[model samples]
Target: MSFQHTDSIALSELEGRAPTHSDLESRGITSSKEKDFKEDVKETVADSPVDSDVLIRDGVQRKLGQRHIQMYIAGTIGTGLFLGSGGALHTAGPLGALLAYVIVGTVTYSMICSLGEMTSFAPISGTFPHYAARWVDPALGFAVGWNFWYQSVTSIPTEITAATILLTFWDENINNQKIYTAVICVAVISINIFGVRIFCSTAEFIFSIIKILLIIALLIAGLIIDLGGGPSGERIGFRYWRNPGPFNRAGLVESNIATDQFLAFVQIFVQAAFSFGGMEAIAIAASETESPRRNVAKAIGRVFWRILIFYVFGILMIGMLVAYDDPALLTDTGNAAQSPFVIAMDRAGVKVFPHIINAAVFTSAFSAGNTTLYSSSRILYGLALRGQAPRFLTYCTKKGLPLFAVLISSSFAFLSFMRVSKGSEGVFEWLVNIVTIGSLISWLTINVTFLFFRRGMIAQGIDMRKNVYHNRYQPWLALWGVLWLSMFILVNGYAVFFQWNTTDFLVAYINIPIFAALYFGYKIIMRTKIWKPHEMDLITGIPSIEETELPREPPHTIGGKIAAVLF
Candidate 1:
């Protein structure tokens, strides 16, 4: 009932300046005989007003701040760092796993930096998905939007399955896994239905603090164990790294030593990619973020350092304490017993710590699952507003809840039931592989979209110096991200080449074909063209965005200053 229509404004703004044939040719948009294509695009956009303003869902205001964004990211860290690292540890050895995480982390940093720059200019919901439509093609936008929504929807069940598994860490003899799963599903859905302020400001903030405290405690305990301060007074000191050797055998082979190690490294590389999947949640929160441009800029700048502390340092400690061949790492119970962090503590004779760590793991899993519902529903609502999805999804309640979208997204939580029959570990890995592939494509789309965005800005003569947030080495960073991600996408199914298992191949490579079908199918139906560089709407929402003000300056007290730096 409260939707803001962009049609009239977009129609007048774009129709006033249809690009001439010469202009199109100069920008490499068309062949000499393809003049009709340019006119088609001009006419199409002129009639459709792309919504440039943030739709006020049920009177919700932008209230999320820097602290909220940081904690949201922290909660998104999930249980992967604690439990899922076992597979990587076994496959790649300590050094190999560490290198894999470092590589993926670097790529993710570059990707989010590019996104921050773009979102600062237009802090819209469906952020990069909207940019894809404007700067590239409508069909690309459609494909990416739905792909991301699907990824988020699937991730909910994955985290629920993980939560159930974490409970098992305390009582392996328990018989109520499904009951636990249902409780988590209902809790997260309820949190999302209450709208952004409660979810981001309270529930997520508290859960993230628990997560941060747990990681810090683990880090200190790990250091103590490595330094001979544990109950056994044993100084582990990278003993595992040296003994199992630096690299595990690749292709699960023993004789083909070099090849086996290389394959194993690749396996670890992909697992690292999966572990870092949800770190981009801050970008999704841009529409609801108070002083979005400034806050998002601050958050993005700090993301890399956070990754270093939580992931790189955490991985380093795990490597020091647990050997790749440890029987604990090989357990498929889908519980915290397999957590390298728990394993490390148990090995040091700290028997009680594992229970504490397992409780924290449950908190991390539930928080991550809660975040997925928010992101998925918001994405669907954004799509509905843009006419890419069923219009009912855009309907919001007085509390700013996208009720229909939330319900639809919550329905996917039932997917966790698959674990009941398929086995929790197997089903969890299935979900992880699919999510990893989808996220990689999403990252690739962000980079390519940013490159086009840069071209349009330069073509329109917008000065970057005066902008509040701008990345300096863009197009290059984007270019490298695209190239690197492309290589990984091609080789994501490398395991199949060695043994040729049908399930493994499908799980690894199915997303590519699915994405292709969505992209081309939409292209054919809409008759859209690859948007030329000079023709993109690069400055549509700047005036309204500029009028927004921060409620107050960031904290200036001594403790606040320290928080500003550390967070």
Candidate 2:
């Protein structure tokens, strides 16, 4: 993501034309040879009355602040970690789950580092999918952009459905689920309708804080439970691992300890990958962030801590408290009823904690859906800005909300309504099947794009140190990500192989062919050529971004310093 510097003043010569309010009207830059680029500029500048300009001036306000970006690193910790960890533990045992999460965490951090560099350098709203197009090939960008948008749209309903189930944990006799679904959908959309400041920054910041507090409380409770602080006063220290023996042999047909355990670990690895899926959503707010060079990198740097504390430690606590063979882990009560935390609490004979944890799970589901829909809208807005989607999606309200994109993505929330009644299960399953593998594909694209992007920077003689943000072992880190993930994705549904279930195999591998279709389809139809190293255009957007963003003000006062450190 870093560019080359010719001398000590890396950006001295980089300074170029600045954007002003008077430039709001069409740039009027017409180039028949590069019609797509010309049209992209027009659509961007025209976000409000006309296209995309200085982020503050129009088309998505530079509304996200330091706290928003800082808090948002953990913004999407949803049912996956809270509830799904139980399933992961059940499948892979304690040590296996921990190892799985550590592996994914490593890959996730590598990808994030590369992303931070690119985002710091460009700070474009279009984010990394577009980076694939610019740095790797346009066809790859087209595939990734559409795949990510579709993935986000589908995830909103999935969270809403989880929220409803968590609500039923409170009121089991509740019927006519549509009313509840509609209510949750409205609440999520209502937050975003007001604009980025209200929904993304303020709301998500609050959501993340609550989530962090809840997790810390749970971890403390877990420790107490492990130390026999519960009503039974039974010290349960690592006894479950010793008894069940640290491996479940969950789905294996025959009992080969080594082979079964290895297969089990693979299963949890896939789940762990999904758990860390949305960290890259950090880039979605690039344009709207006040100072991308400063804030975006800060947020990326903190991702490691979030993953360690929230996920790795959280799983450790679950494994410590809940045994792999705990029957509650297999329950179909369809709420936090099956959450390993609640399972642990129930085993400890703690009566009240389940209610508190369930409430948090409900909040988690709602928060995740809220943020997912917001991200989906922004990704669509990016797609439209890049001419990959319908032009109308680029339209923005006066508050810098991508009005049309929001509306379209919001419509997808209705998919949650399928849960209102029976008989739609088939269709719902089909929809979920479509985007099941989207996360791995997105991660793979980021690494691949980074490889090309790095090559381009070197070819142009750009100074690596001059990059707005620099992390060591980059191109190499990204290269490892690319190879490891390609193999990981291929074996994503390894269980399907031993069992030979068509639906499961398809669900696991569906995005592969879909991505290939989008890539080859676009290549054949548009006749676009892959970009050569020297031809990559990192310079086009950075100059305007640097000129438009407010000057960086380093934190000085104690409060500011504390905020900076925490965020």
Top candidate on TM-score is: 2
The global C-alpha lDDT for each of the candidates, from Candidate 1 onward, is 0.78, 0.78
User: lDDT (0-100) at residue 322 of candidate 1?
Assistant: 91
Compose the digit string of candidate 2's lDDT tens values, residues 1-567.
222222111121223223322332233333332344433333333321112232222277677887887776678888888889998999989988988888888888888988888888778767887788778887888899998889989999999988988888878766846778889998888887878888866678877888889899999989998999989999999987897868778567575778888888887777888788788888888778887778888888788888898898998899889988888888867687888988888888988988988888888888888888888898888778777889888888878899889989998888988766689977897787668678778888898888888888888887666777788878888987787688788888888777798887788888888889999999899887777776665544444443536776888899999887888
Q: What's model 1's overall lDDT?
A: 0.78
- Candidate 1 weakest lDDT stretch, 10 residues: 1-10
Total clashing pairs in model 1: 2
Candidate 1, residue 559: how far the Cα is off, in Å: 4.7
338: Cα error in model 2, Å? 1.2
Misplaced by over 4 Å in model 2 are 1-58, 253-255, 552-558
Count of steric clashes across candidates, in order: 2, 12
